[model samples]
Target: MYQPEEIRILIVDDEPSILKFLSLGLRNEGYQVMTAEDGLSGVNAAQEFEPHIVILDVMMPGMDGYEVCKLLKDIGNVAIIMLTAKDEVEDRVKGLNLGADDYMSKPFSFQELLARIQARIRNQFPHMMGDVQVGPFRIDDRRKEIRYEQRVLSLSATEYELLKYMVVNHGLVLSKATILDKVWGYDFGGQENIVEVYVRSIREKLEDREHQLIRTIRGAGYRVDLP
Candidate 1:
């Protein structure tokens, strides 16, 4: 996975002070963060934020951390570290039982919490945002490098991003809009043809003229599968 610098985190607690402290400390440690001061609000923020990690407090008004954690698990498998004064064995057990990846007792040092969250994220999505291999294609997510069959194909930065995006989502019929959204970010003006242009370039550079992995879906955008 990418380092803490690129990781997005959510810190949820009723205590504004703790939320502020963790947010500052996590940001200083090179992680992005969003905070919520209550349990129900935390859930809603999580839905919108799509954070990589969530720091939750056990006691909160309305929903509480356990319920929030359970609800998050149902939505998706996000790394969760519970932060609370309830340090009893049963409390820890309950937190883990509720699908928390880890827990931190209150009065926690930021160093420990940050370390635990990083480790948990690594375990969850080790290859997606990290060095990865899919068939003959080798990907270095950090440096944004890719190679096929030991040959490095010359690619422009956008072309590289587009190709890497396709390989990462191999076998998915990704629409041009979806590709633009993920690779070009939110500011991409309407330019659907840009995707078609780059996809064709990637095909020319990465594959032999005889065999190609990128397939046009007629009405859809593209799909990446082994040739």
Candidate 2:
């Protein structure tokens, strides 16, 4: 499992007290936390810091949460939890439509927010959480290891990441570009064929010579399905 210290959180709010309160609380929980006073700064920090989750306030002075949420979704893979003093259902729907993963009205309990963060981490990035099972493969995130039918599979660092990414997103026919962008970061200098090479290596280690575990889609990328 990923330790809390490995998870980065970005909190953006106009209120100084709210920022301080959340920063201290999340820090105490062992999360790597960063704060921004407004929507613009939050977007800037997300680009530089590349936080896993963004805690955004809806009613900011300029470039409200809605706009910020749109821009953030365009930027990279990030889970957003919106905060608002408004408790209307319309407001919640609006946030969700714009790509916020979760929402919380003001005056929410700190414990509840903490729970939501954990939930998002599990739901959106299952590979980062604790043990996960897909088909006959079991992933131990804390140990950074994978076992197939109780037999440990030797995997290099990149192979481990690629396999975990595919396994966590089981049953999805991931495109080559998408896999490259997600596993190898957008900044990776290698060619897209690198994905094919890693897939071959992982398949060999999994003893999937028949290509049942990680199957390549014709004209698409690949998929891992539960049996």
Candidate 3:
């Protein structure tokens, strides 16, 4: 029942029920739907699908949603929505800290998914506005410019999103999942290698070099905190 909409979507969940249900429902709504059962595959599917949005399961076997999210975000320009059973604020905060675009709790309804998808579509068309300042980086939405130390940084669409997401979540020890969700959105299902690429790109673009900013959290993901 997939509609004729131009938007493509990816749904990642460990549960077959959730994945199939969402895929069916979303397709019926005029979107091209793809799915993945595990975090790693989800990343691969995302890249191939080139989805407009990614719906991620927070808890999954093999690498987990958080890690997948992080890797995905690192690549750039995808919208991520994290769905989870854990309703704790910490979990929510963790997802947000990682840079997910939105979140949903488990047992969510089809109607809710439709609504969320609609919103994601709406986001594709923007209302150009003022700049967003985070740390030393300045995002000029109007000019589509990024400045660090008065030096303009050139970026691809994905790179812009990656940097913006990181700066927005500064001071948070964001996991890859969180960053992926925030920057890439849930719709991107592809290899996690993209995240690494973008982070490296961002580091070269933003990091002062002398003072290390984007630091790896060992067991966690990445962080950009001021000293």
Candidate 4:
């Protein structure tokens, strides 16, 4: 998974205030952020920065967001979120039709924008987002690591795989057979009891002594439930 610092975001808006506001807020969130005053500069920045996400404004003087979005899509696989002063359905549809991944109206809540950014990354560019946040866990597949509440957990290679599998499939009840097949491979010659042992070890590391996070589903196997 990619860390926030590893993820690049480009903010393109003619408005100075919006640019400053977004740049500061996104940088505070730890992303590598760049700003562009208009659509043309935004495209230039996208080419140089190769940002994973772009927050683009629709009404620009020279090129406008639709054209820029189209060009960006042609250039690379970027997740583009369009910002428009008008909240009309037609504007939203136009942006989407031009390959914008998401749309936001002006005066939008910063928190809501942040949520949309995370959602786009989760849905569209999962592999590029670095450390992805699934519930309370931050999974970094690249480093083969997991962090709970910002603290990195010490885990072995197999332990990491088991925990990552459980966390990725957080709500489902994973049976021993399924876990073994997915994590240990289908041809592994281990008994089902092995899943239980690893689960206990992972729970200890997670400090889930009360069995709150990872729970035993009786006749079923184990499930990871985030509080």
Best by TM-score: 2
TM-score of 2: 0.60
C-alpha lDDT score of every prediction, in listed order: 0.81, 0.88, 0.75, 0.88
Q: Please, what are the lDDT tens digits per residue for candidate 4 over residues 1-227?
A: 54689788999999999999999999999999999998899999999999989999999999999999999999988989999999899999899778887788888999989877876665456567567789888988668788999999999999998888787667768889878976898699989999989999999999999999999999999988987
* Model 3: how far residue 200 lies from native, Å: 40
Q: By the TM-score metric, which is better: model 1 or model 3?
A: 1
> What TM-score, computed on C-alpha atoms, does each candidate reach?
0.57, 0.60, 0.55, 0.59
**Which regions of candidate 2 are displaced past 4 Å?**
132-227
Error of 2 at 159 (Å): 25
Count of residue pairs whose backbone atoms collide, per candidate: 0, 2, 32, 6
Instruction: Indicate the worst ten consecutive residues by lDDT in candidate 1.
Output: 119-128
User: How many backbone clashes are present in model 1?
Assistant: 0
Query: What digit string (tens of lDDT, one per residue) describes model 3 on residues 1-227?
Result: 11337677889998999888888887777778889999989999888888778999999877887888888888767888899998899998888667687789987877977766655543442222256455576767657677876789988888877766665556667777656765788797876667877888778766546437888778888887754
Local distance difference test, candidate 2: 0.88
> The CA-based lDDT of model 4 is what?
0.88
Question: Between prediction 2 and prediction 4, which has the larger TM-score?
Answer: 2
- Give me candidate 4's TM-score against the actual structure: 0.59
- Better candidate number, 1 or 4, judged by lDDT: 4
Residue pairs clashing in model 4 are: 1-130, 1-131, 1-141, 1-142, 2-130, 2-131
Error of 4 at 16 (Å): 0.4
